[model samples]
Target: MSDNASFPHGPRWFAQPGTARTWRCASAPRQVRDFHAALTGYSPTPLTELPSLATELRIGRVFVKDESCRLGLPAFKALGASWAVHRALAERAANGERRGRVTLVTATDGNHGRAVARMAHLLGQGAHVFVPRGVHRQAVAAIAAERAEVTEVPGNYDDAVRLAAEAAAGPDAVLVQDTAWPGYERIPGWIVEGYSTLCAEIDEQLAAAGVAEGPDLVSIPVGVGSLAQAVVTHYRSRPSGHAPALLSVEPDAAACVLRSLVLGRPVTVETGETTMAGLNCGTPSSIAWPYLRGGLDAAVAVRDADSARAAGDLAALGVASGPCGAASLAGLRAALSGPDAGERRTALGLGPSSVAVLLSTEGTAANPRTVTDE
Candidate 1:
């Protein structure tokens, strides 16, 4: 694994005026939750409250939404991948299409491909997963375990995405990608919709814990910004006026969303290699850009070393997190300890009374290097 200490950790703060008052509720959350529950055997993941960590961070409370084992998978990708695949198959069946054996294709660094492959195998369909260079051997084996055809691209994740798009050009092949471009927005939108389930679960868990008003701050990891977009949409759509200060976290090596926010438009970055493999995205998803641009309160790009340290921190808290999963905690710690900590905290509304929620997106199963005490 590469040491990421030399990378940039400059945190950016953006406050969008009238954003909290402008958002309106859309009737999609209930439908999304119902769909997942009825078909996917969905159950809410644990929202664990860590008092010790909260005391250490000097916050009122800290909740970690453990998505490591979502739907029997070691990551949260199954929530989106299963829903997208089902939606695609349902659409095909609605059109009276009788393509013999449907095939699903997508590009992923690791987790999403395995989820897509699992969904395809469950639905009695074929799957083709394209992974970028430098992907871990365990991840490739996991995808192949689902009987999906795994293809390793020679270049980066963006190159794998392009190759997957080319491979899915056939009539019988459906591309269940989580990121969107020009003509491929619908499925990705559905993928975002699928992630609404996690936010809904969080809300219920918070209420059950006697905090009915919801969290004041939320830290989420961004790949193509799909999951962060989902978080924004869910919170903004609530009638309870629960607009948490959204914090978007990403690896410094591939901080496409951060770069896009800085440029004031969607732009691709170089996306160099990082230990946060699941977040090694070069570009932001077109479908997610608008929400992220308007709803994000702050964005931070953390080095791989920060994430490695964060994984160890989470492990000490009894939470098994990978580098990508622990990036939210890394960003939080960065915000609280960086040179501009005072200004950043004031700008983000972080204080003694603030309740924060961190999304631990995946478990430390594939990447054993992230489990060290270093």
Candidate 2:
């Protein structure tokens, strides 16, 4: 079967989704290479094929882009967020600014903050990460491990964003926020550019396995949609015949992408409850909207029950994923087995021979199984 046949909108659908013409990021190959070079000492994450899961699902093949093993940091967010901070420092240094005096600021529920903190420590800069009240203790611990000062504020993810923005409004503090509003574009784009590394590695791994055609679908989790945008952008830049159908997964409580897809425009929904803290972003980011609206093929919002269940499943399977980490697999598992599975698969032109990949972004955060019980 033709690769594009499974996807109703075809492989170039991302092009029409309104992303190609929007504020394009510096996502060129050279930038990707430079970003990779900046972290030359770090080890590359693995792309492990899950033959057992594929057999159970009755699919031809399935691969998990495992980012849990990245530098002991659990998530792929570190790749992008850290790269953005480093690049921002590079930008400052290029302009003759004192790099050591620069401080990076960002709002996070967890992973991104740790990434920023990690970068700050490596580059001789300071970082301050803001998190919503009731943020996960383990997440805060992770960021603190990188020597960053962490602050918690009242409200949800949105409130933390506002607090961070206020702090970043000063001189010598660069806002490295993942969610972009107006007049602040570079960091978010750089985050996406950092994400290109994941896709680029996937390309190499797939080729090594002798898989010539692209996956039938690529499923990813969305918070502010930075990683999703990056994946879609990277895939779109490739030859049309090689790109896969892109699907985004989110916590049901924070179904911003579903709302956006349904409304045909961006909309923020109140995320009242979810165990998938990392995926609990209530609103779509302004910078992420263009790419999301243009490149995303479908979205599935999984409930907290499924997220926790997927987390447990990964643990049983010895994969070690957190609630937020296993969210994409939860959504994909539902999409492949629930009421919409068959139709969705057919509509997207997937079949038994089609290969699909899902990214497991982080390991169990604070889960006793993930860390040796102290």
Candidate 3:
């Protein structure tokens, strides 16, 4: 196989006749409203300006979308996966699937698994989550607290995903997977829609603050590209006359999205070599591919060192972040340093007048063993 080969793995085994149809799904305004309502108990995560970091980089402005407080989940995955599973359960109930007990299943490196477990527990259903072998102990414990059964697969994230899909297909289980391929499209799309709330809130907050246009650039991390797709979708659909350029970042070893976008298809790469464990994805989700292919403006792959440094920088600035969450800032930092980065900045008309946003997608507590490097 080529180093950049794209892998297609999913429920093609049991896919119905229409399973291979183009998987294009979007969040309805009403469903989005319902999702927001259900999640009201979650504190409105703060969007704070990183004045100190901005000054040091001489970037016009920088803002951090702090997701640490999301439903006490400490990760932004709570918004997407949990809300998606909730919506899925409601839909199943509408279809009479809830007359009997329904279970949701998925595989994760960590946070998405926890979100699925929490949603299952809250909705009176059971969940069986498959996790990668090297997943952190704390993350596993957190998922277990949601009362979900956790099984460790003997491979990487992609391997766990394969196993989950296999199990969910057997019998009456509902697989609320974040990555879509053949038969599964609706649930993953719902997950992406749930994440749209974050960007919508950012736009409203910035507008209310008297910033007419949106940020000059927005950076987000990629793990199967769901969150990145959500941000891109929201900006593309934003009513604002102007939208910021979207940049997606990933760890060097798991830059599958970058490779996929370049080749115009989903690709798989190596795993287990990056410290940004949350972004240690091998392939981009089929559900998220079209959004990244057309909606996002750029993609960057940064070294583990840069991501680690960003986590440290965030911690120093009173914003706690793990390596995966800090990958976006590392992309921003690289975009500021390279020669073409200057041109990209100029093309975006960014100067001291421009404002930028970086998404801190997880709390440092997710990886207690990962210390921020000085």
The lDDT of each candidate is 0.83, 0.74, 0.75
**Candidate 1 deviant stretches above 4 angstroms:** 1-29, 366-374
Model 1 poorest 10 in a row by lDDT? 1-10
Pairs with steric clashes in candidate 1: none
Return the clash pairs for model 3, or none: 6-267
lDDT of 3 by residue, 113-142 (tens): 888887788778889999887777778887
lDDT of candidate 3 at residue 45, scale 0 to 100: 74
Pull out the clashing pairs in model 2. 6-348, 6-349, 17-294, 18-294
| Candidates 1 and 3 compared by lDDT, better number | 1
- Highest TM-score: give the candidate number: 1
Q: Indicate the residue-level lDDT of 286 in model 3.
A: 90
Candidate 3 local lDDT, residue 373: 16
Reference-based TM-score of each model: 0.92, 0.88, 0.87
- lDDT per residue for candidate 2 within 244-271, as digits (tens), equals 6677888777777766766678878777
Candidate 2 off by > 4 Å: 1-27, 37-40, 366-374
